[model samples]
Structures are given as structure tokens and as C-alpha cells.
Target: MPSQQDDADPVDTSVAHPARRYDYLLGGKDNFEADRESARLIAERMPTIRLVAQENRWFLHRVVRFLAERGIRQFLDIGTGIPTSPNTHQIAQDVDPTARIVYVDNDPLVLAHARALLTGDPLGDTAYLQADLREPRKILDDPQLRQVLDFSEPVGLLLIAVLHFIRDDDDPKQIVDTLVSALPEGSFVAATHVTLEYMSPEQFAAVRARAEHQSAVRSGAELTALFEHPRLQVVEPGAQSVSRWWPDEAPQPRPSIEDVACNGILARVGPRSA
Candidate 1:
């Protein structure tokens, strides 16, 4: 995993950034004209992108709550975007006031906003790390992460809606494997990824071309394969649309597959086979 000099990187507001564009799509005010323009171009092709972003956020909420209820407390959430309401730490700490979270993101703006807004519960703990997800070893070895979490215990490794930004050439699978390898048995890896499987050929091509960040949208099988490391086993409900995965309360009118284009899974690491 290549490491960019986090300190040397400057915030370029002139160019649309993935985190800022996502914040804008989610109706947050931390975006600039460049981000809005980028979002506008993408929304022009798939108008429901905002809805898709919301669905992915909801998935994060549900998954965090589920993991907390299951007694998994420590969280290493990489690619954490701008701090939004009911953020990952908020949801996890709500379930268990002592839950610990380490929020990691490469964007300096995200780091700035997160450090200011992502306060932890008095009973719990939270820390922010400005780093790239590609360097799993660096993240795992960070002193801040070590300070907040106990690697010996079960942890919830969150990769929600972030992996799509990593191109296939980046070896995203190796990144995942490296992160998972550092986690102890009983730890859970939950991830949500954007997919092109549901889109028409023309729509898929158009969205990819307009996307500000290079994306590697995968098929269901390919996405599922990301969690197929020997030490990890995918949990029930497998990989499916976020809205369709264990809904808390059904909407009056259920959302169709077209309503959400992301697939997610919660996989657990267990004892190595004899």
C-alpha cells in the first residue's frame, strides 16, 4: 500500500473531491461550488444518487447497531467522510456507552471537520486519523489506533461506501485482507460498495465517465469475493441491496432495487481451520 504524505497534501477546493461531493449529495453544507458541479453532473445521469447515498448511510446505522448489540465494540472505520449526524461513533456508542471508535480518512478537510465535530461520549472514546485506506499496515500500526482499541478483542471494521473509490489496480482485495489479518478472531468486517450490476450498459458507462474519482464498480459475485478471505465468513443475509437487508420497519411502499444501487455484507473472522 502506497502512503501519501498526509501533511504535505493540501486541500484543493478548485477540484471536486469524493468526500466533499458525497457530503453535498447527503445535503451537507461542507461542500464548495466544484463539489456541487461534480454532483450535478453525476445526478444528471442517475438522479437518485442522493437517495442511494441516504440508503448507504442507513445501512451504516443498521450495521453498527447490529454489531454493537452483538457485543462488538471497537471500530476502525476507514474512509470516514465528513462528520454527519448520528455518525458511526454516535450509533455505536449509543448502544454501548463504552464503545471505542477510530475514524480514518485521507481528506484533510474531512480530518478537520471530523476532529472538530466527532466528539465521543464521556463514557466512551473516539479518535481521528488522517491516513489512506490503501496502507492497511500503517493504519493497523498507528499509535492512535493502538491507543483507542484493544486488538486482542473483537472489533467492527467498517469499510462502508468507500472501497468503490479504490480502482482495481490498487489491489483493494489485498488491502482488505491486510486489515482483516490484523483483527482477532470474532472480529467483524462490514462493507457497502456501489455496483454497476443493476444499471443499464449505457447508464453504467455514463456514470463511470462522469465520476470525479476513478471507480471500480463490481458485479455481485465480484463484490462478494472481496470478503472471501480464508479467515472470514460472510454472515446471514449475505450481500444484497442496502434497503433490502434486514429492514427495521418496512416503508409503506417498499423501495425497489432501482431505489438503491449499493450492496453490503457483514463478515466475521473465526478460528483458522485445523
Candidate 2:
């Protein structure tokens, strides 16, 4: 099992956290009333919100497997929500027991559960860091991250279902650039974000107004624009609803984009510009 670096702040259950709320949506018992309340409100606006969460999770599993199959043995999984089975490490290590993974999250509760449940294959390594995505430098510079991941090799950077939590003022583009820039050439970045583009005008306005306190949903175009870096190239299929990213691997009769309302992208990092 891996050790967890503690966050100074105690867990505040009064306010709803995206991670806890996500766990709740996934039918996990690790959430509090506030998280359930927040998810309930979101579900009221979008009846298929739970299915959206499931599809996003499945997307993460598929992307990890894809990266692992392509010889990506190390991963930096940020915004790792509460311990869900078949986690990033589980899927990657399944493909190769030697795969190393580093999980980062701001929530102390996530850290607590992750330390206990996120133990990867003994042949590999796993470490948990309590950190915020807004501070990419801190995550990149963390001693645990450096110890677990080797910069010389390609890494799969997973931002699954978390980027929407970052508000516009947070400069998400710059944050993503800083992290992607630090990776060596051949590294891959995969991200999934909530979007309202598939919704009707009426539902979009209603959900947007109510969900503003929790997330900053971006359309597929805006989400794609976040990876506008000289060394990054979008993978084939470009930006698509999470359910549609790899429909062949997904369950038959895939849900409509309108129900998923989320976009995912995978970009590979090329050699640094001289």
C-alpha cells in the first residue's frame, strides 16, 4: 500500500465537493449529505446525470487501457475521485503489473480512502498526493510524484471528469500547459469535461444557472482549445462525447450524446520546440 501526504485543512463536510458528489452519483457510500444534495439537484435538471457519470468512468477505464497497450507504463492521474474499483492503476497494472501510478486530489477524504484502497500491484508502485489542480507546479514539483514517475519516459496524464471544476479565472489552459510541458516527449494527456452543448436551449439555461456553483462546463470546442500547445497533437476522433469516444468497446446501444453531455480528448506530446 502507498502512503498519503496529508493536506493541512480538515475535511469540511458542510460544502459539497465535486469528488464526493461524483462518488455519490456513482452509487458509492463514501459521500455525505451535502454531496448527495448537490448531486440530487444536478440530477433533477438532467435525469441521465448518473448515466453520464458512469460513462465518464468507463471512458477513463478505456483510455487507460488504450495508453497502457501503447506502452505507457507510468501515469499521473489528477482529480482522482474517491476510490472506485477498476481505478487507473487497476486497469493499467492489469495490462502490465509493472505500471506505476500517482494519484492526486485536493479532498482529504479521497486521500484517506485512496491510501487504503488504491494499492496497486506489488511489482509496481502507487502514491497519493493531496494537492489542487489549480497549482500544477506544486503537483509537478511534489517529491512523491517525482519519486513514483520518471520524466524520461512517456506518461499518461489523466484529467478525467475533473477539469470542469476549474473556473475561468483559474486559467485552466495555462494550468494544463504547465503540466503537459513538464512531461517528456511522447507523453499523452487525456481529459473529459462536462458540457451542455447537447442540451436544448431551455435545459441548457436552467442547468447552467443551477450548476454554476459546482462546475464551469465547457463545450467540446472550448474543451479542445485548452490543449492549444505547440507540442501537443489531438488523437484521432478528436473531441467527442465520452460515450462515443470508443463505442466499439462500450456497451451496445450506446447512449445519445444528449444524455452524456460530456466531451473527452486524448492528445500526445511531441518533441519540445527548440
Candidate 3:
């Protein structure tokens, strides 16, 4: 069994956290009243909010399987929420038993559930790190992460439904660039971000007012801009609704972009530009 690393701070149930709120939206039991209240407020504004959460999670599943099928055996998954079943490691290891994964999240509650995440196929490895996404350097430099993932090989960097939590003032693009730069050539990045593009002005205003302090939802273009590094080449279809990212793999009659309100992008890291 892979031991959990990092000292997690005490969970504050009085305040709403993105991870717990996401768990609540996904109908998981790990969330507290504060998370449920926050999710309810958002759902009241966007009736499809629960569907959006479900679709985003399925997107994570598909992307991990996609990368693992392509021969990438190691992954760095940041923003690991409350342990939903068949997590990133579960999906990737299902494709390749030897897949190695490192999960990072700021939620103390997630760390409390780290033992469940740390279990993987005996042939593979999984480690949970309690950390915030805003500090990419700290994550990359962590010794446990370095021990599990080899920087020399292709690594699938997963930023699913988490980057939007990073405020613009925090320089999210720079943070992404820092992590991508650490990857060797042929590594890939898969990210999904919440968007307000599909909402009407009134709906957008309502959601924004409710989410302002917690999330920084961006437009499709803004989400794309975060992967602007010269070495990062976006895969087919550029940025599109998560529901439409790879529709054939998703359920039939895909949900409308207006209903999902999230965008996903898959990019490959190439050799650094001369």
C-alpha cells in the first residue's frame, strides 16, 4: 500500500470549499452543510449544475483512459476532489496496470480520505499529496512526487475542473506553464475548466455573484490562453464543451453546451522552442 504523505490542515466545515461543494454537486456523502448550501445556491441558478458536474467527471474518466491507451504510464492529477469511485488512478490503471499516479489537492477532507486513493494495483503506485494548485513549484519539487514519477518519461498532467478555482490574479497561466515546463517532450496535459460562455447575461450575473469568492470561471478563449506555452500543442478540436470533447465515447445525444457550461482541452508537450 502506498503511504499518504504531507501534513493536512484541519478541515473547516464552517466555510464552503470547492472540492466539498463539487462532491455535493456529484451527490457524494463526503460534503458538509456549508458545501451543500453553496452547491444548492449554484444549482438554483443553473438547474443543470448537477449534470455539469457529472459530465465533467466523465470527461476526467475518458481523458485518463485516452492518455493511458496512448502509452503514457505516469500521471500528475491535481485538484483531486473527494474520492469519487474509479478515480484518475483507477481509470488509468484499468488501462495499464503499471500506471503510476500522484494526486494533489488542498482539501483536508480529501487528505482524510487519502487512504482510499492510495490503494492501486500491486503493479502500480499511487500517492496523495495535500497541496494547493496555486503553488505549482511546491508540487513539482515535492520529493514524494519526484520519487513516484520519472520526469524523463511522458507524464499525463491532469487539471480537471480545477484550474477555474485559481483566480486570475494568481497568474494561472504561469502556474500551468511552470508545471508543463517540468515535463519532458511527449508529455500531455488534459484540463477542464468551468465556463460562463453558454449562459445568458442574467444567468451569468447570478452565477458569478454566487461563485465570485470561490471560483474564477473563464470563457473558452481564456481557458485556451492558459495553455499558450510554445511547447504545448493543443489536440484536435481545440477547446470545446466538455460534453463534446470526445462525444463518441460519451453517452449518446450529448448534452448541450448550454447545459454543461464547461470547456476541456487536451494538449501535448513538445520539445522546448529554440
Position 236, candidate 1: lDDT: 78
Worst 10 residues of 3 by lDDT: 1-10
TM-score of every model versus the real structure: 0.93, 0.97, 0.96
RMSD, candidate 2, Å: 1.1
**lDDT: which is higher, 1 or 2?**
2
lDDT of 1 by residue, 83-188 (tens): 9998998999899999999999989888778868988898999888888998889899988789889999999999998998888888999999899888899999
Q: Rank the candidates by TM-score, best first.
A: 2, 3, 1
Supply candidate 2's per-residue lDDT for 56.
96
Q: Output the lDDT of residue 35, model 1.
A: 95
Top model number, TM-score: 2
Write model 3 residue lDDT over 178-238, tens digit each, in one string.
9999999999999999999998999989898877877898988999999999999999888
Off by over 4 Å in 2: 1-4
